[model samples]
Target chain A: MAEISFPLPDLGEGLIEATVLDWLVSPGDQVERNQPLVELETSKSALELPSPQAGKVIRIHGAPGETINVGEPLVVFEVPDNTAGIVGTVPKDDAPKRRVRLSAVLDED
Target chain B: MSESTTALLEAGARDEQSVKLSMQQALNRALDEILSTDPKTVVFGEDCGQLGGVFRITDGLQAKHGESRVFDTPLAESGILGMSVGLAMAGFHPIPEVQFDGFAYPAINQIVCQIARMNYRSRGTLPMPITLRVPSFGGIRAPEHHGESLEALFAHVPGLKVVSPSDPHDAYHLLKYAASRPDPVIFMEPKSRYWQKGDVDTSDAGPLTGARIVRPGRHLTLVAWGAMVARCLQVAELAAEDGIDVEVLDLRWLKPIDAEALATSVGKTRRAVVVHEAPLTSGLGAEVAQLITQSCFDTLKAPVERVTGFDVPYPSGDLEDEYIPNIDRILLGIQRVLEYRRG
Candidate 1:
């Protein structure tokens, strides 16, 4: 199993920090991807942040009413080693498909 | 190159006590070092305080430097830069962040009028010792304006120095060096390359300004900046197999460009291709091409070729691959320069 630390994502554009409103799930609870993880109150509005992956919660950071900065640790989860538990760009896993001699890629004209 | 620049290049070559660091980590470390060393230094932007920046380039900075020195500001880009001007005037080396390259648009009034001209306007009595950090360029499929390339816009200004780092070592040292400069420096961080990991020497004071030859080839030269530097290096490697020896030059500084380096490189190879993510016309590539033409005109083999984005608004994620100059486009550019026939 691998443990993943999920940071508090940018709740809104131009928002740097958010107040912890409530935790829907406690540590040790198994959660599914996109499940309601916690409620955060930013300057823009209050909303529930969803889980980025399916895993068992290992740790939860900040108490209700406590504030957490964007990118700060929000939750820790335990999952299979092969599973990725965060959001962002997808990894390039396959061998580049366009491998050819430089001559082949260039045009004669 | 001067003695210090050569020393930095050599130190990078030596790779002493190097540690693998992503551009994000490297920039963070550089900011940490700057904040700790300079008592007057301050870092702030929207979400940069406790949030550590939208991309987390300033991650954990507020905790380490404390809220007073490293804190967040309102979403107002103008306010952020206007405060930087005030902070610099008050003897503080204000290191303000614009959050993203696109966000800088709103701050142009402050950036161009105040930060870029305070030195000249004040007759150098009060120089804006500020480093405006903007996570620049595109590849992560961001929305419109989020991935804009404004090097030409910033470079056009008189009193500002512009730079972008292609790797971790340069990112680490260049950020620290920019903060140390007496003049305001627009430090453009390639957004897509932030997650890239490479060996960075924390002590390496990378070139304050000037281009460095990352790869040397005898047949032709591929000149690029920011994310395009890495792409050029890759093209050079692939070209090597096709019997085309391509030299890769990273133009670290956009303003006060190292004309000497351009002359030296194109002078030897006599063939050059400049690539950038910005649009074709009025891009920084045009200036570089002019510089090469002016300096190495007599010895040129063919006109300097430019493989750049279309002359349109920089597209968002879905059209990024189409907009950004790809390996195929660059290879064709190389072929054009390498197989040029004098008419």
Candidate 2:
């Protein structure tokens, strides 16, 4: 399982920080994508921070009434899928060398 | 797109509510609208519900539409298509998706014999209004059997209508049109172009079926579909550097190809080049060349040419660079057609 951290997104207008109003999801709760993870109060209004991805909630960075800076970790999620396996590969270092001269094709004319 | 996929419009209306979306998102929205509008329509395929497909084209659709409408099926491609045939027979519009272009092979019998000929065999009684969504073509460097261009195989079928959208707008519109058709449509979704973002006007659509002349030019016509349309557009740009005007045509429907569009663009330019990912031997390019020849032979400046994949089996991702026709190869084909002279 991979632990992914969701950073607090800048909710427009060059906002710097937001106070955590309430935690809608607990640390052990499994959440769906776009689910309400936490409700935070911004300078202008209070809004719910939705989970960016669906995963098991591993940890919460801020408690209620705490201020978390923009771009700071909001919550950590443990993703279940392990996709490391045999798939397509682009070997950047071993890119196939290719060269074509139009002279050879044009010679037919 | 540094060069956007432009549909050669005839007299289509444009909408004010255009969203910059990827082809996948456009398709998802189209499916959502299809499910919402048509209560008889059903969408099901392997891993399409929970995992939201390997490409995530069906993401959040299952939760939104519920299990009965947008559900997952068994891993069997044949079974999925067979079930689609049965569902269509029961007066339902079945929009079944095969994970990849290569995966459609297992369901060929059900697709060709049953789905293609159902209406004809029943004398227009039982119509198979099935839109088989296949993630097609190779550019993502996918492994063997993960990327295959099966357009020719499907297009050769008598009753099947094959379509591959070059951009998100067309992807959104053509899919909804295909789902609404009474006949079966092999909707080839260019897997590589899924993430290519473009402006999708969800309001109104242009022509339902026909090749779109994305770039209008006076010199020559570059005909292509699916992933190759974008590549041909890129090549057209490169060809422009050499002062060669190239008209890029997106052949939307492969079965009943826009012969008039081919005739119009090629008749105007008098030179044509067909590009495709399928193998050169008996590929759809051959048919396209013949069509251009038949239509624009009298006014043609040069013979029709084809730039395509090698005759060998579609290889794994490692050899894709060498297998699939690159921009240079297409440019070479264009050059060949440009320099052709009758001996």
Candidate 3:
């Protein structure tokens, strides 16, 4: 078995962080891929996050009523080797970059 | 556009190898191309992100392009328009979707005063290349606010370019062309024909400016754009039974009004009928009719006529059929123009 850590995925619409409203799974619970592992509340709405892989929950990083930064580790799971990167977490630097420059076009136009 | 580019587009439009798809599907394909080619391009509006838009025009975009390039915003028209101004000013090609034609009023001030005047306001120092997609026109049985034709409101503004595509083919090509421009464009989609299927050639399918002669005739000219184009075509087909051959001109580019193509058609037909879903008074039809009268005064056989919606708020869904111009109403307008004789 290999350990996989799941970070909070970008909830989109400029939401950078969300509150961990509740955990749907506990340590040692068998989970299937895309199972709701936790519920998160962002500025927009409440969302249930699915498990990225079929695994055994090793640890829950945050408890209920805790806020988590996007890309920060939120859960740890032990899964079979072939299914290790099933959800496929990219490194922070390798993640798709958002538009950060809005003022640069003015000077050139 | 250069002559070569124009020739290329004509070839593309006439090419038979194009894939058949609905207007909405073609729009999706074009958006996919726009996002794939341009790193600076981004699309957003209410429910545009996770929901892929109410019409599903932006469906699968957020997932494919990632949330950064395709995302949603709050339910504020002003904020969306205001933000687009800044984003366009910053050299990004931002395609902001106005949920519907009626919903655009809340942001009209920003659209008219700011978005339209950005370049002129700065004396050419700023070029706002924003493509605002607004699904407009009636016939969908959509509620009152959802089915209005307000293209004339934008066409009246000087700095803005207005375009409405009549079919799936033009919808894909015109949208891509609008997105690539240096100035702002109001891309109006006829919601009624959103699902109508047609052949769409990705290669060089003509420039965004000028009119297209969808049907050729020698007796009279029927001028229309957007949803009315289809109705006008139907009118032309039915008018054939009466031996009144009609020429149908799709004014794809509403602003920078394809005056040359329109004049040529009116001059040939000697009689004209302008059709629109907007109210008769101050509608784009009025301008087209005036242009035809001025250019083809000697060739005219009768006074130019207009078939349009009444000057009232777009009525509820039940009455929309009676409100918006239909084929029979258009044929009547045509026959009225054809029956006229100089005293």
Best of the candidates, TM-score: 1
Candidate 1 RMSD computed on C-alpha atoms after optimal superposition onto the true structure = 6.8
The worst-scoring run of ten residues by lDDT in candidate 1 chain B lies at B200-209
Looking at model 3 chain B, report the run of 10 residues with the lowest lDDT sum: B50-59
Ranking by lDDT: 1, 2, 3
Candidate 3 lDDT by residue in tens digits, B53-92: 7666787788799999999999999999999999988888
Please give the DockQ score of every candidate, comma-separated: 0.18, 0.11, 0.02
lDDT of 3: 0.83
Give candidate 3 regions above 4 Å deviation: A1-109, B1-17
Chain A TM-score vs. truth, each candidate: 0.74, 0.73, 0.73
- Chain A of model 3, TM-score against the native? 0.73
Error of 1 at A33 (Å): 5.6
Query: For candidate 2, lDDT tens digit of each residue in B42-69?
Result: 9999878755677667877887888998
Estimate the TM-score of every prediction: 0.83, 0.77, 0.74
Give the TM-score ranking, best first: 1, 2, 3
lDDT value for model 1? 0.86
lDDT of 3 at B36: 96
- Better model by DockQ, 2 or 3? 2
